[model samples]
Target: MNTRTVDARGLEPPEPFERAMEAIADLAPGGEFILLLDRMPQPLLRMLDRDGYRHDARFREDGAVEIRIGRP
Candidate 1:
């Protein structure tokens, strides 16, 4: 499967969310959207949940959050 990475680590609010939304819209079946964020994106997570997308979030050693989203 192909994985599209969106680096939102230094980005401000709304930008990260917008980028994530764009990635989700462009995601294909059996593919993944990897979002690198500076903090836990709670709002984004909620949106993903409401949109019927499955996702997982993990913290990196440097304190960045990595959110992986995919279709069920």
Candidate 2:
């Protein structure tokens, strides 16, 4: 499966969320969207959970968080 990545590290509130949402919306079945952020995106995680998507978060050595979201 191919993965699309969105870099949201320096972005302010709502922009990262919006971009992630847009990416999620455009994802095909079995596709994955990876979000690179400065910190954990709790609100977005909740939204993904509510929408029944599967997700995982990993912390990078560079102090950024990588959130991978995929269809259930």
Candidate 3:
């Protein structure tokens, strides 16, 4: 499976999350989206979950976050 990684180290957390959703909506019909962020908020994560996007998300102690969006 091909995955696209959006490095959100410099951008604002919300922007990266929005962009990741757009990317998933655009590309995930055929493949998947692998979102990588330095840090993000919990509410946004809950929003993603409530939106019914099939994902595996986690925040590391080092402040890195990984969110994988696959078929719903």
State how far residue 31 of model 1 sits from its true place (Å): 2.0
Judge candidate 1 at residue 48 and give its lDDT: 80
TM-score of each: 0.89, 0.92, 0.69
Q: How well does candidate 1 score on lDDT at residue 65?
A: 95
TM-score-superior candidate, 2 or 3: 2
lDDT of 2 by residue, 6-70 (tens): 99999998898888989998988778888899999888889888988999999999999999899
Order of the predicted models by TM-score, top scorer first? 2, 1, 3
Ten-residue region with minimum lDDT total, candidate 2: 1-10
Computed on alpha carbons, the lDDT of every model, listed in order, comes to 0.86, 0.89, 0.72
Backbone clashes in model 3: 0
lDDT of 3 by residue, 11-67 (tens): 865787678768866864546677778765467568768877677788867788887
Q: Which stretches of candidate 1 lie over 4 Å from their true place?
A: none
Q: At residue 59, what lDDT does model 3 achieve?
A: 80
Model 1 lDDT per residue over 1-72, tens place: 557789987887789888888888887776788899999988888988998888999999999999989976
User: How do the candidates rank by lDDT, highest first?
Assistant: 2, 1, 3
